[model samples]
Target: MMNIRRAKPSDKDFVLDFCMNTFEWGDYVYRVWDRWISDPSGLLLVYDSSNFPSTSKSIPLGIIHIVKCLGDILWLEGLRVNKIHRNKGIATALLKYSLNYGINNGIKESSALVSTNNFPSQKMLEKLGFSKFLEYRYYNINLKKYRDDCNVSIKPDLVFSKKLDIKISQFRDIFSIQEYLSNPEISKFCVSKYFDSWRLYDLNTSLSSLSSFVRNKELLIIVNDIDEIVGIAIVKPSGKISFNGMPMIQISYLNCLNLSIFVRVIHLLLMNYCDVNLFNNAHFLLPVFAELEKILSTKSIENSDRFFLYSKFLDTTSNLSSILPANLQ
Candidate 1:
């Protein structure tokens, strides 16, 4: 019999230990895995029965991390089974539990990403109910090595500073990006989540949680000749951040295209939006990504990640296999 339950706080250290002892994910993310407890999303645990045949240790068989948004999707990450217990049914049991948990929790989709060379893991995920929808290419740029590249200065009517030195709180002052996504033109260009703004480092103290929060936390709005908002951009310090250990940039609201006699504001942030010490994932329109890259390549922003317009589907026969749903979390 296997025991699966919500991971307890005390299990944090054990979970980290099991993962570090079982797999290899570079030294950086290795340590960061333990910090995931702060996530308001979801995280879980896996344990084996009398099968491992151990004497003194209540070693965990595996561990899985999850993140959830308002929708029915959940992201599964950091799935690990101790090397000493590989051949057993521990991994299989963990997946089954997660899948069952998803269906019960109103989660329509659950998913994850596996490297091309990771054969056994790929086979395991597919066998459990996952399918590949896309392949991601990762890249990186050293800020100091290429700082001469940013060239967009066509300012908006409003510029949300990268430093949160100002205190504006009204809707006009602090316009949440998600609130603006309903606008037809704006929604089309949105490649991130509504609550993503809430997840920025401005709200957290951990450096891993910090990014260009100092930059992108401020919202910018640009308008056309008629005062209709048209474009928006962010300015982030050159750094990186990700759920687990991916690289990213913290970009602040730059120039919005048009439409604004009102104020644009932010709640908190502004330590070092451009601090060379962190990482962030300032984004561009999904389509603009390619163009932005070619343009940034000429300058110095390192391109080391794939910014997904992350989506998940749910149903009785949906993509039950490939997703890493936090709901299942």
Candidate 2:
């Protein structure tokens, strides 16, 4: 028999051990373990089976986490199962439990990021009704190398502000950001557009739980000659260096209406954010946009990773085609 329960502080070591022993490539669960358990808006569940019992406690057979991204946009991540527990319907049960939890709590849709090479996981998500919506390419760079190669300089005229009228407190920021992104002229500057399901959030719930985990977070907004906000860059902490075996700052979002502005903002991010040495190392993570990639290609940085964003609307009657861009579908 298998039993599932909400993970408590005492179960931290068991959960971390299970993740470390199960995954052979790399592990992100340990990096976010503390945050997941501490986040009030998220749920971390552990699965225990009599089949994997230990002398001290029931060794967890599997684990899953549900993170509330905005309103109805719940991010499912850190799904893992012990080797002895594979092919035994453990993963399916955990997924169903998570989905049901979301539905009972008023979640309308769920989203997840999966590696392109992980076919089994992708198959599982698809079997569970998820659709592959977008693919994001990320580039990882060491600050030491970046400084050595980047000789060109641009003025830091762009202003960084978190006081924009749009607040991400409870999904309100989505509307503000979406309005700017919906502009065809501005959308052209982006490599990929935001998914429709992500834009929709429950109006009744409080999204303030999101602000706790992010550190040194800020919104860098760029203005045009007329002093109007033309572009925005979202910045957040990349967790500890040991989490991914490196220190890096993750630029969650970057948008600009023109190449000149984009170049200026990119330079500013490197000089201001990536210059610090955290955990004895300096590095940064920047998603490779087509325009930025072209400009940085001359600097000899290699593309680090490519992943796909998968989403599933719990509502069977959802008109996803209407919400999603024609090209994305």
Candidate 3:
């Protein structure tokens, strides 16, 4: 058995090398880890010379990056064991350590995410005591779907709309990024706990650096009649096509409202996220199973049992699934 340590600054180069070689989507892996590591609450699990039993140097064999949610749940965002070190039980050891850490440290549960095609990793997770959980959607939705002829029902009194008029050149600066927590019923569903101001600003800076990136995006603000930011639709260029006729919304933003209104937000997000014309993520629909076909003309994403799962098990985590919604988009 090899000893493990939390990743340190010294491991940055080695870790980066491992990530580049092992991950099929190095950008995706780096982006997710970068997003989480902004706070010390983020975690990294690494294996040294021991786990491999053969490595002479404590080469970076595997890594697991986690994000904290309400203290109870930890998202195992990035988990990889080097290809050279595969089949040596290193993956299992690192995961077991992390999961035990979560449970022991009062984390109620842990979740691991694998792309739909990564069946091998999924099988490994199952062996480590993780069962398949809810599905999720991820995307930057295509904004070309708004139709002038269509009468989509948004509360006129509470709904607020603004046309993104900034020049495409200013997509990053005056990107018109608006954010508010909604009763996921009224607004679209695309948000996370860490989508705070800092993260948004960071996204602005980072996305700006990736210039020449085609951007058919807008940040739609859902304001109450009083003009307070109540909800937000984080529209972006999904590049993902939905059979429904629009590019998909890669992600959404919502503030869960009262149970009744929450239902509406749920419907809104599902419909928006599911529209295949844009691309859809149906597994994100929890607490409801309104037939995809009944709700939309064509549900683009599959409602699958295999989902990217996370758990919440912190002390202050009571009712995070239901709490005073914050201002996020």
Candidate 4:
């Protein structure tokens, strides 16, 4: 008799055991387990298979996590199944339970990010009624290589130093940022999401929503000679540390009006925000835009992988029985 239940501290060992080899490099499930278990606005669920005849004691076969983002968006992530338990409907069952939990909590929509190469996961999401919403690519910029190749000085003060026709400055005014994001021309180029502490959030431009970034001093603006905000960058520390033992930072959301300004911002960030000794690499996700691709390729920056953001609307009145596999239902 398999069952699903809210995760507890006792299940940490089992979760970490299966999650340790989740990827080529490793996994971040251990890093976030405590936080997810304690998050009041989120749910961490574990798949219990201890009651099965083959089990002698408590056995956790899988896990899934979901958290409420801005507005009615439920961000789902960290779905993992034990290696020996793969293809047995554990992942599907966990996801179905997550969606039903969201519906009961008044969540209007649900979204998850999956690697472009993960065809099995993609097929499962499609079967569960999620549609592909947007495509994003991760670019990893090596701070040392970037700075040495570009011959830029890594000075903290360089953040405000003028270069060519533009300069980078931290923006703290929530109202101004909100107003800027409201521009149709600008908003169209922006992804509808951002990252905070490795958790994805819906891009909310309201004063209330923008205030947190402002308070944390994570928001930066690229201004031209005339002080026009032509670009924006949101930086935050990643949940996982780099393999080199240094911290990693993410340029969560970045947008610029032109290639020149974009390159300038990147250079400034590598030289200033991303300290070579302090950070291993800086990564960001950008939409699959042709012009952006041209700029990145021209600059010789390395793009790691492509990801798809899948989303689904949860109708409160609809039957969720189809979400689970026929046997599970």
The candidate maximizing TM-score is: 4
TM-score of 3: 0.49
Superposition error at 266 for model 2 (Å) = 3.2
Per-prediction TM-score: 0.54, 0.68, 0.49, 0.83
Candidate 4 differs from the real structure by a C-alpha RMSD in angstroms, to one decimal, of 4.7
Write the number of the candidate with greater lDDT, choosing between 2 and 3. Answer: 2
- In terms of TM-score, which candidate is stronger, 2 or 4? 4
The backbone clash count of each candidate, in order, is 63, 0, 42, 0
In model 4, how many backbone clashes occur? 0
Candidate 1 residue spans exceeding 4 A from truth: 9-14, 18-35, 38-41, 48-50, 54-56, 87-89, 114-122, 134-140, 148-248, 251-329
Error of 2 at 196 (Å): 18
Q: Which candidate is the best by lDDT?
A: 4
**Which tens-of-lDDT digit does each residue in 60-123 have in candidate 1?**
6676666554445676666777676677767776766676566656677776656555778777
Question: Candidate 2 lDDT, tens digit per residue, 67-125?
Answer: 77755577888888877668988888778777766665567889887877889999999
Give per-residue lDDT, candidate 2, residue 298: 37
Looking at model 1, residue 211 earns an lDDT score of 31
Candidate 2, position 123, lDDT: 98
Which ranges in model 2 have alpha carbons more than 4 Å from their true place?
A: 21-25, 51-57, 151-182, 189-217, 223-230, 238-247, 259-265, 274-303, 316-329
Off by over 4 Å in 3: 21-25, 29-38, 140-250, 254-307, 310-329
lDDT of each: 0.45, 0.58, 0.45, 0.72
Minimum summed lDDT over a 10-residue window in model 3 is located at 194-203
What is the lDDT, from 0 to 100, of the residue 79 in candidate 2? Answer: 89
